[model samples]
Target: MKKIKIGIIGGTGGIGRWFAQYFQKEGLEVWVSGRRSGPDLPTMARECPVVIVSVPIAATLSVIEQIGPLMPEEALLTDFTSLKAEPVRAMLRASSCEVIGLHPLFGPEAKTLAGHNVVVCPARSRKWLPFVLDLFRKGRARIIETTPEKHDEWMAQVQVLNHLNTIAMGLALKRSGFQLAELLPVATPAFEAKVEWMKKIFGPNAGLYAQIITHNPFVEDVFENYQESLRELKKWIRRRDDEGLRKRIEQAGLFPAVRMKEE
Candidate 1:
């Protein structure tokens, strides 16, 4: 039985490179395409039975538009975009190929997929869905099957809101003219850890983070809710209401394991 060849567009580095190497290790023939190197986009589409778009957020849709029409009907066309809905729609609209939206919930530098979550939005076919899921399972990744819409909705809080708070803290510190070097000496363990995490956001992939925050449709509501919470917290702090602050803290802790029941 001949194994299907997989082509990863933009697979020269980062998650694309990771996927290219990972899939190769899983015994699949993998080809790659990148901006300045590797195989060309049209060539990958025409050659491989499965084409994975592993480009950056800003370039994803345009890449999809380019290769979507070139893919064969039996090809599995998927993407590694953080935000799902738009890319999935683009793939479906532009191609008759099997479409899936995948978002690996960890960075490219992760050593292993063990215990990591991989969200799979199987928008189109059953042909490649099982193959993809089985591969992730073999890698010890937790496979989360979901719709593109629901995935984007949750990512509003997961990625956008989380990045928002991190960026906001870093900005607040900057605006205060507080020297990070001076603060390090007095920083607690949690503060030190948070500072390191904030460095990741401020360091690389700034554009990717920005796109995730701005492009997500549900993010506006997330931002509103976050601001409202901050304002409420400010009111309690301004009044020096010890009991109000304590109650608020306790209320938040009370629902650690609570899940919303489907309505």
Candidate 2:
């Protein structure tokens, strides 16, 4: 039997390229497009049975707006973006094709899907849902079925807050004017580990992280909460309120998330 051809917009590099390699390994024919080369957007939209929009967060909607109208009704249209709500909505509005929103929880640098999670928001999909999900299962990926709104809300906490914390630390280090060479001599295991991990985010994934932080609708609340925490911590420090600080620390250890009733 002939393999289904998959078209990935912006698949020449990064996560799109990773998906191309992954699908090819599963015996599917893969075609990719980018600004510089490969197949054009309308051609990929019309030719492939499954057309995935894998452009950067800032460009995802624009690409979807242009190509989504070009897709055939029988084709499946999906996007691999960190924040799903807007992209999924655009796909639904612009295309008559089946729509699914996918956000691979890990970066392209990951060796394999293995234990990693892939969040799937099936917006308008019926027929193509099983096929797309089965492919992820074959790659050993844990599938998280969720609504686009819920997924974006969760990512505001997961991606936005996490990246904010890391960026804060990097900023603090810069303001302190402490050379890494000086810090390295006495760095704790945890500090060194964070430094190394953050280097990857601050390096190649820097723009992507920035986009995720800024594009998500729910991120403003996350930032407000973060600022409030900082102010509260500063107040405690200024007062030298050891008991207050201890109580705050204890409250955080409660891990309220783990205790939430499963939906």
Error of 2 at 58 (Å): 0.7
lDDT of 1 by residue, 1-263 (tens): 78779999889878989988889899999998888988887789888989999888988999999999999898899999999999999999999989999999998889988999999999998689999999899999999999999999999989999999999999999999999999999999999998987998998778889998999989889999999999989989999999999879877765665523311
Q: List the lowest-lDDT window of 10 residues for candidate 2.
A: 254-263
lDDT of 2: 0.92
Q: For residue 127, what is the lDDT in candidate 1? A: 83
Give the per-residue lDDT of model 2 (tens digit) for 123-160. 99889999999999999999999999999999999999
Cα error, candidate 1, residue 190 (Å): 0.6
TM-score of model number 1 = 0.95
* TM-score of each model, paired residue for residue: 0.95, 0.94
- Tell me how many residue pairs clash in candidate 2: 0
